[model samples]
Target: MSHPMHDVLGRWKAAFDGHRPGAMAELFTEDALFQGFGPAVVAGQDAVRAYYEAVPDDRRAEVTVLHTYTVGERVAGGFADVTFSDPTGWEAKVHMSLVLRRDDNGWRILQYHVSRVAAGG
Candidate 1:
């Protein structure tokens, strides 16, 4: 079955793989909080765009949706396991989670975070 979250993630994946930083930012809310692979967390769409812009153009992301949820009719969110790969075959795996809120513009990400998925403890 298809979910709204799937559609959002699908568009995100397309933008990411295409290295369209501006396009990716459009999916996020104006004040969205973001934490990519960078050290400090940033806020807002401009920061989000800058973060993606810094990523290598050849790097592509494959996301596996691990879970999803809805908070009433105005909010929804999900967790995903993502593998980012480059032309040289180098890859980085991480766990990502995002929350979205419905507004006049439709569902836009309110928060987006990424963290390293630890290896065997």
Candidate 2:
């Protein structure tokens, strides 16, 4: 059996790898705050959808969960290492952090942030 973190990230990974931007956005809350690989941070599910819509269709991501913690009955947060690659062998890595909240709809991402991974780190 998998934990909530795995359940959520597993779905996220599938959506991202499958190039389903809309499905990716569905993983977040309506008021989610997102800072993807872009320089700008955006809020709301609409913006999250827009941000993911810019991802290259051939690009896929592999996320390794580094840590996760429960803040309360309704909140949880996690850290992960994410590697993105395409068919051409181009790759990028990032340290990702996320906060999720539970509602009647299970867990939804409330905040998502990513930082470029340093060389040799």
How badly does each model clash, as a count of residue pairs?
0, 0
| Model 1 misplacement above 4 A | none
* Residues 33-111 of candidate 2: C-alpha lDDT, one tens digit per residue: 9998779889998898888888899999899999988887899889999999999999999999999999989999999
The C-alpha lDDT values of all candidates are: 0.91, 0.90
Q: Highest lDDT: give the candidate number.
A: 1
What TM-score would each prediction reach against the true structure? 0.94, 0.95
TM-score of 1: 0.94
Q: Which pairs of residues have clashing backbones in candidate 2?
A: none
Q: Where does model 2 exceed 4 Å of error?
A: none
Q: Tell how far residue 2 is off in model 1, in angstroms.
A: 3.0
Model 1, position 41, has a per-residue lDDT of 86
Best by TM-score: 2
lDDT of 1 at 117: 73
